[model samples]
Target: MRVFVAGATGVIGSRLVPLLLSTGHDVIGLARSQDAGAGLERLGADVVHADALDHAAMRHAVRVAAPDAVVHLLTAIPARIDPRRLSRDFAQTNRLRTQGTINLVDAAAQTGAKRVITLGSASVYEPNGPDPATEDVPFWHRPPKEFIPVLDALRELEALTAEAGGLVLRVGHLYGPGTIYARNGSFLHQVQSRNVPIVGQGTGTFSFTHIDDAARAIVAALETTADGALNVVDDEPAQVGEWLPVLADLLDVPPPVHIPVQMARSAFGSWGVAFMTELRGADNTNAKRVLDWSPKYPSWRQGFEAELAHPGSP
Candidate 1:
């Protein structure tokens, strides 16, 4: 199969390209800059230089590539976490998810592409009580103000993909090489500096996906005919209090400091506090069952240790 990947130089796309190549698929990677294009070239992917937000460029590129499938991996994330900058930092990514997604889907539809695999977030799911969130669960109808745009964009992106008979992988909090959860990533730096803290009872559940595992899932999606959304999370869903200390231990840092819920809300805003206190974990049962995929690292505990050992791995 021939595949065209948007955000080909991104955290997941970078890893995914090699996997697709190794599996005997020809790849065309969309790059926004000379350096990104060069990087994809080094990976043996034919490069298409165009920003994802440029609808005309995307349509032309996809039509030129004439791939059997298109994969959307575009995202813009801040280097560091700043609760105050949430809205500003997410604005570009929101645009990418909304406008970029539409462009990619339209390009695929126009080019007669058969498969479209796009990334979605598990965070869009409403809290699912004690259970992990399945694809059937309702989305947060009334999300926090800062998150409303993000969720709205996600919904639009997923809807467009599903309507086109494409697949949407609702991935969990990613944590591996080139991601914020990496050894030298901002999250680690914050934990080492005691900047991120445990809030309230720290009971909010988090489902994690290693970069390698995520790439594997995308590769698997290429061969499967599954449509709509499927959760691509690991086996274990951990609480903030549960994972923070373990991550601190892995980083050789002191356990995270505890703050009152109100203090955390004041410091990190309502969204951040909600992440630590109310968010639910994503269940990957459908992905495993439908795509015949399983994560190599099914727990953050094992994934974090491996990441620390390797420092930087693709």
Candidate 2:
């Protein structure tokens, strides 16, 4: 199979290219810079230089690749995000999710691609309520704030891909070498700096995924052509209390200071609080059953250790 990976320079894209190549697929990647193309070339992927937001360029690149499958990993995160403004801010990423997904899906159709697979987030689910949420759970029940626009874009992208052949994977809070999940720099960055405080008794249990697992599950869907939403996650679904001290321990930092849930809500708003302390974990039975995919790292602790060592796995 010939595969074209958009956003080939991203955290997942860098790892995904080699995985597709190892499987005997002729891989082509979208790169916007000479440096980005150089990296993809080193990984044995044919480079297609174009901006994903540029529909015409993206369409042309896809047509040129003439791929059997198209994987969408494009995001504006690298260009805009910094340590100062982290995941707490997501409006630009939201635009990339909604509008960028629409454009990429359209480009896939124009290129006559057979399958389309997108990287989605477990954050799409409501923060409170039942643990271990499934793909069939309703999405619009929550207020239209944090996860709605992104999931709405995902729904639109899925609808468009279904017209061809499509799979949308809702991945958990991402962790890996190059991602926000690894290193004390991300969530731990806040914790270490004492910028983060425990809210609501630290009761919310959230889903998380290793970066390699995320890249692999997405490509697995592309290879197998299994359609619909598959929750990509690790074996462990953790509560805030359970993971916080563990993470702080890993970084050799102090435990997060606790704050009242209402105070936290008033300070960060519902979306921000839910993201930091939420209880939505996604079930991965469908992905394991259909795509023959299982996470190499059973939990974030094991995954994070390996990730901090590798620096190249992301």
Candidate 3:
């Protein structure tokens, strides 16, 4: 199989390119910068340079690669996120998810690409829904005000992928060497500084994905005929109250402090409060069955430990 990947040097893509190559797939990666292109070349992948949002450039890149499958893992999320300015911070990423997706899908169709796979988010589901959300659950009907645009972009991305008979893998919070959950990552820094406090009850649950596991799922998706959406999360779904303390303990930091919902909203903003109190976890049953994939670190507990033990490993 010949595979073309956008966001080829990103957190997931860096890991994904190696997996794709090891699986005997000929890979061509789109790198937006010279350094990124050089990195892709070092990974034994053919490199193409193009801005995903530039329709002409992207179309030309894909046509040149003429891949059998196209995988879109493009995103521009910052290392440290400001909960108060969620929409503003995510504006460029929203465009990537929307227009970037449109350009890629159009390019794939033009070049007769047989498969299209795009990344989606577990967080886009209604935060008040069932504990472990399945593929059938509707997206957030009333998401936090600040997250409206982010959610809208995700919805559009998924709808577009589905329209193209592609698969949208709704992955959970990705944690690995270079992700936010890493030792030198923003989340760890916040925890060490006692900044990420628990809101009332801390009921919001999270389903996490190891970067390697996510990369493997993408490889599985490439080989399978499954279409539509799948929640590519690990086995365990833990609440903020459950995971935060454990993460703190693992990092040898003080456990997160608890605060009232109102205090949290005032301190961290509405989306942050919803994230700590109302967000629901996603289920991976469908992904497991459809993609024949299972996460190596079945729980965040194991993943956290492994990441800490091997600080810079993927």
Candidate 1 on 131-165: residue-level lDDT in tens?
89899999987777777877888999889888889
List runs of model 1 lying over 4 Å from the truth.
309-314
Runs in model 2 deviating more than 4 A are 78-88, 144-148, 308-314
* Cα error of candidate 1 at position 198, Å: 0.6
lDDT digits (tens) for residues 30-124 of candidate 3: 98889889888988999999999999999999999999999999999999899999998899999999999999999999999999999999866
C-alpha RMSD (angstroms) for model 1: 1.2
In order of TM-score, best first, we have 3, 1, 2
User: What TM-score goes with each of the models?
Assistant: 0.97, 0.89, 0.98
Clashes of 2: 0
**Reference-based lDDT, residue 139, model 2:** 63
Candidate 2, run of 10 with poorest lDDT: 79-88
Task: Return the top candidate by lDDT.
Answer: 3
Best candidate according to TM-score: 3
